[model samples]
Every structure is written in structure tokens, then in C-alpha cells.
Target: MVEPGPTTPTSPATPTDPATPTNPTNPTPAPVASPVATNGKLQVVGNQIQNQNGVAVQLKGMSLFWSQWGGAFYNASVVNSLADNWKVTVVRAAMGVEEGGYLTNPAAEKARVKTVVDAAIAKGIYVIIDWHDHNATQHTAQAKAFFTEMAQLYKNTPNVIFEIFNEPDYESWNEVRAYAVEIIGAIRGVGAPNLVVVGTPTWSQGVDAAASNPITQYPNVAYTLHFYAGTHGQWLRDRADAALSKGIALFVTEFGTCDASGNGNLKLDETGRWIDFMNSRKLSWANWSLHDKPETASALVPGASTTGNWPDSALTPSGAFIKQKLLQ
Candidate 1:
């Protein structure tokens, strides 16, 4: 996970307009039209995430940094700007639940998530309401309650996706699955049929474990596999490849081109390989972050405004890289 500290802005940003969100040389790339209809919702079908029409769909977009710390990017204007300027198909609302976040202020954190979700829905894009926690199993009741509320609120909307956990550092697949089993049941019990992504052990790098013993209790469940290009190489890809061959539904809910620390030179070569792997699988993915934190993965520079519209100078190399990818 990208550490939230290192730089914390002390003041709340008064929201700004959604204008040019990048440098002029970048020319605020034109937003492309999507073929996917506004009414269609993503569905899980036999190792693939397909559109409502049953065609395999690949979503490319960005994930906000932890909500508790990076709340500045959790606004509708920012979501709209990305959809318009970058032409992304989905966005992940990474709601942090620990370290003075949801546990300390549940209502506020939930509001942060809802802001992005509401924006996605209004803009006709898929949104992942991620429970951004490392030890989600430890807070089973909290996870259940948060998901249940979200499921009920967006029950009929196909645009909403649920991620019960973010990263599990050292849990067994059996243990992670046990936590997922209950949380998945809770979301389904609320009559929400949208796709739910469950995190695998070891920071979601244990897809092979989930593949060996799949979650059979639910229908629209997919295993999450997160990777950072500098840290995870072919060994990780081989694991994911093996799992895919076994017919496990996998989703790249979060990933970065930099190292695990979220700061490192962009390993262009390695990141390219990971992109190729995901493209081959036609996987849906959201980049690690949209924050202006001083990290290689942040995509923006420190002191960048909270508004979604950023200038070229504000964009980091990773931000420029992601904007180009979203265009594809």
C-alpha cells in the first residue's frame, strides 16, 4: 500500500472548476467516446468481467489515494475531469478505514466514498467502493456494515462494485476466504448483484491460492492481484498466469508503475511488461493513485490543488503515463 504520510496538507481546499487538468503541452487530451452504454453494468461470467450485454469488458482508470489522507481528490469535479479528459471507464474510491479514518470518523469517511461513487454513477462509469484496509478480517463487523449500507443504497445501480478488503499482509487464503465468505454474503443479502472483488493474501499477490480453492459460495466474486512493476516481476506474473489458466476470476484493483514505497523512478520496461500481461488477459485495472503527494506513484506534484483539473506542471511522470493509458 502507498503510505499516506510523508506530506499532509493542513488546510481544506475549496473545490475548484473542472477545467484543464494538465499542462498545455499535454493539451488537455480530448475525452474519447465510449461504446459501452450508460445503462449497462459490469457482470462476472466464467473467468471474465463482461458488460451487461455479455461481452468481455476491460476498464482502465485511476484509483484515489487513501480517503482519510487524500480526501482532496475525492470530489465530483475531479471524477468528471478524468472521465472527460482521460476518458477512463472506471474509478476506484479507496476509502481508508484505519489510522484515524473510518473507525475514528465513520460518517465522514463514508461521505468521501459516496462523493466519488455518486460522481461515477452520474457520469456513467463503474466505481469500486474499496474498503482500503490491511487487516479487514479483524474488523469484520465494520466491513459488513459499510458494505451492506452501500449495497442497499446502490442496489439497483449496476455501476457500483464492492471491494471488501484492500491488502492482507500475512493471512492464509483459507482465512481470507473465510472473511470474504461472510462479507460477500452480507453484500448479496442486501440484494446487490454487482461484482465484488476479494483481496488475496500477501498484498493480493496470492491469486494462485484462491485459484486452487475458489470461492464457490458466491457468483460475482473475483480475486484481486495487486502489483508494483519495480517490486513484482515475472515470478508474480507466473503466479497470476497460473491462476488465470485455472479459471479463477482475477481483477487488478490497484497497481503502480513504481516501487511498493510509491516512490521510485518509473521502471518503464517492467511496467510495460505488466501492462502487456493485463492487456492479454483483458483485465480491468485502476492505477494506484490520483493524489498530489510527493511520491513517484502519486501522479501529481506537491502543492497541487485539490481540484481534479490539474496543469501540466502538476502532473508527475506517472500521471502522464496513466493519462496516456486511459486514452487507450
Candidate 2:
């Protein structure tokens, strides 16, 4: 997530109360089933994301903001709301690793991330555990350990996707590739068959670079390509086409309707084109965020309930647009 100004830290919202019967006389209904029950495990098959049965599948969902900042929505109620109301099939847990994040408070950060992850599992939707760091290469050891632990814990579950790197700032494709190899090895080393996503160079825009030299060792490995419609246009799509032509899979792990700065005008026209492109190519994606920050990318108003019973009034224009897309 890119920020144009300093962020005002918000207190973490408490988790929503567990399901309760509306009336004392009636019993609560069983939770609605989620997409995972049907899709099962996911795999990357030559530029496409396929379900365990080898059929192409596209997952539409929202991404939680950096764990340290957007920790309010990291709970079952939020996930349940998205699954039950917005009809999202997946959600990304962006665990911030630096700047007073996991590096400073590992337990708290991990707990927040796990809250979303476990919620997604209980709701039966896929969840991406993203290492939301810009300088991931420098903390290879920490990342490896973190992912290794996650893999061991969730290896048998098919609802997890490990995003080794969120976005690489100035690193070259080769440098990112080397770091990814180690992380990918750690996940696969633990016998986890879940798909792993690696970020590209220049903040995940260099899909063509990754295509030229893709990871050949991993079977379910996919590359990430992030864009803000206002700042990135057809040129990035063209670059993505080049990567797809090379038989490398791509996943738009994070994107916004505004500019790259995460604040600015909403470019619905360009976002439409991206939707068409992604739909045509059957690309799986998670919107940039589900936070209540004061930005164009934020889905809700500042005072909106963090426990996830948001009405139309609570949603921003961007949130409404994304919610409509997911529903479609």
C-alpha cells in the first residue's frame, strides 16, 4: 500500500460478537457455505489459475490494508460480512513486516494476520498471507522463518496462499527472483502444496521482466502485478500480455481505483478496462484495501463500524464500485 501522507494510527477495533439468534426463541442458522467448498485447491497452469480439477477459475475479493494500520477489520465478522453480503471469494491479509510492524511486535502482528486467515478459513474463502514489505530481500531470514511456520500450520488446508513479497521497490528481477526462490523453497520444503505468489520489480509492475526469467522449479508458483488504474493504463496491460505470452501466471494481488499514491481521483473508466482485461484472461484479483482510512482507496468512512455490518452509507464510492464488481 502506498501513502502520500503520514498515516494517523487508529486503535484496533474489537472482533465482532459471534453469531447470535435474533430472537431468544429461534436457533441460529448454519453459516452460508463459501467458494472453497467448490473450488477446493488452486493451482497455476501455464498462465491460468485452475482449481484442483484443472478447470480455470478466477477469484474476486478484497485485501485488508497493512496489518499495522488497518487492524480493525481483522476478524470473523468482517470476513463473514464480505462472504455473506459482498460475496467475495477471497481476501488478502497484508501483514506489515517493518516500521513498527511484525519486526517490532511479532506476536501482535501475527495474531492480527492469523485472525483474518482463520476467519477466511472458517468462512471457506481463500486467503492470501502477504508479507507486506517493500524491502523484503533484506529480511530474507525473517521472511523464511515466518512463511515456514505458516506453511507448517496450514499445509493441510487448501484455503491459504502465501505471498512471499508484497512489492519490491528498487530491486531487479534477478534479486527478487533469488529471494523468492529461497522463500518458495521454504514453503514447498515443508510439503505445502498451496500456491505461492512472488512480487515483481519496480513495485510489482515489471511482469515482463519476470516472464523472461520465471521460476522454473516450482509448480504452483505465480507472479504478482499491482496497478492503480489512474496511474497505470493499457501499457501495463500490454506488458502483462507479454508476460502471459511467455506462459507465466500472474495474479493482481493488490490494486486501487485511484492513483498509485492511494489517494486521488477515481478512474472508473480505466478500472473498467482492467476489469474487462482481467475477466477475458480469467485473472484472480484482490482489491487494494478494505480499510476505513481517509483516502480514495479506503472502502469505508472513518466512523464506519469495523465489525462489518456496513450499509450503503458506510461505503465510499470506491467501495461501492468494488463491491459491485465482486458481486458480478
Candidate 3:
């Protein structure tokens, strides 16, 4: 059972300046776009990612799962602290299930996503918008529509990367590949060339699956795999070898204290091995979570109950390891 973290506060709506004109002819102009590259294929150089330039860049980021279930990480100070102070480069957001187990309510969900995305962007960090679910039953036409809309909206913005789906276990590779193809095709149809990250079968924890079928054919596509010492170790190594041999880019997007079996949590040895592998490969990664929860648990927030406030010092040894490795 996953534990809950501190209830993130609600953000007050940004009230428009009342003194500003209300009519179009006498209206205030929209904010100017930041000079950063906001569109086109994500630039990659050698093994490192970059913007338009050829600079070697690494993504040091955090994952925000608090937005799940309609909640918000309303603390801008926390966001700024992580991005500006902690030097996080990206923020992975998980869009949770709404009513009837569907990822519906696109407008509301997108707005929620934008809150975090905009926060990261304001801090000059990249943002990854993840459709966090593994249930194939949830991947309906409406979900595709939502993604397509997102693609169009961020088509011109390079700072945003759209993760087509989260961990997708219980489905065969053929099924996942087909779903990916369809979803990717739809997103591309909208003329958006942002980097698209796709997950493998078996909860996206299967590195072997990703290594077996390299997704190099898709433009700006990066294969993503999650890891937890309890569930994946040697398999991850094998997959990493496969990725290296195939010359395909891989991202170890999510991992944490758990072992390969997902039994007990916080296996330091296994975590070290995985970290070593990623470091050797110079791969990009995002830790499983940042919120305070438990030591052996996946959430970073400490003392996080199944339903309660998260602890302040939840950054475990593993989280610290991740921070050291990625927060370069």
C-alpha cells in the first residue's frame, strides 16, 4: 500500500490586476515568451542533451507525484527550492485518475500539469509530463485526445517532454508497441516534435524489454525504464548492455529504495549497483519521488502515512545518493 504525503496547499488563483483595462482595445498585452527554445526536436549531443546549442547537458530533476488524485503541490517556495536551490533540472508530473478510473477532465488536468510545468520553466528547468497509470483499460480514445491536445499546446515549446504512458505492466510487448505507435502517431500528427518517452511492458521496470526492441526508428523518442533493487537488478544490467550494444538512448526514469522483488524496501547495495550502472552509461534519470514518506518506502517524504502529512526529513540515504549522482 502506497502511503500519502503532506497535503500540498492549494494555490491562490492569480488575480488579474484590477487596474488593468478589461477591453481588448485597452487591454494589457500577454507576457512575452522566454528566449529559451520552446519548440522543435529536443537537441541531443553525444550522449548528453542540450537545447539548440551543442552543449553537453544532464538532467538533474525531481518527480512530483503529489498532483495525483487532484491534489496540488501548491508551495511555490518548495518548487523554487528544489529547482533553483537544489539545482533540479526537470520535474516529472504524474496525472492521476479522476472519476470512473479514467484520465478524463483534460482541461483541469492540463491546468494542474501546467502549474508545475510553469514553475519549473520559470526556474529554467525542464518538465516532463507523465500520464501516470499502468491499467490498459484506462487507455481509451479520450486519453489519446487529451495527449493530442497536450502535444499541440506544447508543440512549440522544447522545455516540455511528453511521456506517453507511465509503467505499463500486464500487457504484452506487441500490445504496448501498438499502443505506443498509435499514441505517438497521434502526437506527431499534431506537428509537435517534442521528445517522446515510451515505457516498456511489466510496469516499465523491464530493461530487457527495452533492450530487446530498440525504439530508434521513432524521431526524438527515448526508451524509458524504471528500476527498484527489489524487482530489477541483473535484468537492468542486461538491458543496459543491450541499450549500449544497440546504440540506443535509454533513460532510467524512476527508481528507489525497493529491491528487485518489490518485497522489503531500501536495499542500499542494490541501489548502489544501479547507480553505478547509470553513472557508467552517463544515462539520465529521475528518482521515484521527492515527497517525504518512509525509509524503505518509495515516497521520499518521511513518516508519510497511508493518509497524512509527509515528514520534513524524508530524503533517505537512497534519495541522497540520487541527489548526489544527478544533481550535478
Candidate 4:
């Protein structure tokens, strides 16, 4: 997660003009809204996101992979379980990536995103529409189109957040920043005021890189870094601390309990320490998944009994963690 802080202005940079048409072939005029001040800060009802004094708001939550491409096994019960049982205040939804074979068709993909977004809104929880796999080659146009539509649809909804790109592994920070800036401009053009989340390099595990560049010029923009304990635990913690020291806001949008050395599958002991650190800092976080069926492909799913059946005792250790730490 990136830490929250003050935004500094960039050097006389002009925000991309919203009225300028990008696609003449699609002659539909872009959505419009009243002009608001652009001071590079997150605003709600014309006010910036302020810290609640020194008290840290516990933002424990989970992510949902509800689209068919991502193995659309999540049902309505899953959503209700998280909100009602886990008391999750946030939900990360993969916005149907283009490569996820299930969403190769654009129309179906849009419908899938709407399904998850609508469910999250009904629960009165903050939902993040993640542009998964935005780092894949030649996805700029797809990302722009997807974000533009989403911004136009949910611009006025404060509970909605936009993650412009999932994890940009191959691109340099400069390249990623340019792409993010372009997408942010497009969303702003659509009159959306939702907080936009930008990813750092190295699969969004580079919080130091994010801090060095800083998204101070974009209002309501938060630098996002994912942490997989199996790969980058210490670095994640150090980068998070550094971002906080710089007064920048961060969200631990993704993490798992695997060992940092990748020796085995899951390691709860190491993850517990990370969780404690996040809680101490008062940082916001979301677990990777909430799927309930072990027969399904998701790691978060509960296990099954004999005869290939999902038994009542199928909950994963991580799921139990959510029940204990986040739920109650």
C-alpha cells in the first residue's frame, strides 16, 4: 500500500483538453460536467481527503474475480458473505481483461464489469475497477476506451475507484507514467471525480519508484503497490514506510501469504507480521480473493471433502484470517 500525503504541483503542465475528440470514427460526443479546480488532490463533495487526525482507519477488505474470463465462479452468495460476514468495506473487481479469453468480446466484458460494480455498490462498499493486464503489449487503446467509458458511467459515484493499470512489469516508470497520465486525462475529460489508482513498475511492487515520481499533479490520484509475500515482503514494507515518510497515500490492493523465497505455497507466519505492520501504520488493504469453492481454480476458495465435494470444513487459512481479523 502507498501512504497518503500532500500533493505538489508539476511544472506548468497542461491537463489534456477534455473537449478534444480522440476518435472521430465513433462520433459520439464525450460526456461533460461542470469545471472543477484541478489542484492534484482527491476531492469529495468539493473537499480533499483529509486524515482523521492521527487515528488510522482500518480498511480491511477482499478482492472478487467475478468475470467469466477470470473464471466467473463467484455468485451473489459470495458478495453477501463478504459484506455480511467478513464486514469488508472494500472490494477489488477485475474489470474483465482483454486477454482473459472469457472477455474477448467487448460487449460481454462490459456486462461482466457492471455485474460486479453493481453488487459492490449495493453493499455500500468501496469498489475498485481494476484494468488487469494493462501492462501487456499494445493495450493502451483498450485501456483508454475502457476507462473512458467507466469514468463516464461512475464519475459522480464517490464509492467507486479506478485502477488504471493492474501491474506494468515490462514498462519503465517514465513509460508507465505517460500511459497513466493519458488515461487520467481521458477520465477527467469524462467529468469523473473518482479517485484514480496508478501502479508502479515491477508488477506494482516498486513503491520507491512510485514515491520518487509521485502523482502530485493529479487530483485524487493514489499510488498503488501490490505485495506478494512470496516475492517482495521486506521491500514492500520498506517502500511503504518510505512513501508514508514522504506523506503519500498508499493502498495495499493485493497480497498473499506465500513465502518470499517461493519455496512453498502459503506461509501465514510471515504474512501475519506484514499484517501487523500494515495495521500499525493505519494503512488500507485488501486480500487477494474471496472465492468459496475449493473445486474452483482460485486459491482463496474453501476445500472440499471426499468424493470431490466442498465440505463445511473447506475454508483456507487465509479465509479464516479474514473471519478473525477483518470480520470481528
Query: What are the lDDT figures for the candidates, one per model?
Result: 0.82, 0.86, 0.59, 0.59
Point out the higher-scoring one by TM-score: 1 or 4.
1
Question: In candidate 3, what are the lDDT values of residues 1-328, reduced to their tens digit?
Answer: 1223333333222212111112312322222442233322355443345456554445656676535432334234455666644566667876654432235455555566766665555555667878776664356566588779777766765667887777776877667777777788888898878778777777775546665665544576776778777666786678667665665566666666575432365677887787777767666667766654333544444433322233335556655666666555
Off by over 4 Å in 4: 1-58, 69-71, 101-103, 134-137, 259-263, 292-312
User: What tens-digit string does per-residue lDDT give for candidate 2 at 1-328?
Assistant: 4752455445664344432212212322223555787888899988999997899999899998887777777888888899889998899999988987889888788888777877777778999999999999999999999999888877777888999999999999999999999999999998888999999999999999999999998889999999998899999999999999999999999999999999897998899899899989998999988988888888888878888979999999999999999888
lDDT of 4 at 128: 77
What are the models' TM-scores?
0.91, 0.93, 0.76, 0.75
TM-score-based ranking = 2, 1, 3, 4
- Model 4, 8-55: lDDT tens per residue? 111111111112222322322212320111112233211113322322
Output the number of the TM-score-best candidate: 2
Off by over 4 Å in 2: 13-33
What's the TM for model 3?
A: 0.76
Backbone clash total for model 4 is 17
Q: Rank the candidates by lDDT, best first.
A: 2, 1, 3, 4
lDDT of candidate 1 over 1-328, digit per residue (tens)? 6667654662423223232222212222122334335337677788898876778888888998888778778888888888888888889988888897899889778878877877776677878999999989899999999899888887777677899999988889999999999999988897888899999989999999999999999898888999998898999999998898898878999999989878885786888789888988988899988887777898788888676678878888888887877777
How far off is residue 131 in model 1, in Å? Answer: 0.2
Cα displacement (Å) at residue 28, model 3? 17
Model 2 weakest 10-residue run by lDDT? 20-29
Between candidates 1 and 2, the one scoring higher on lDDT is: 2
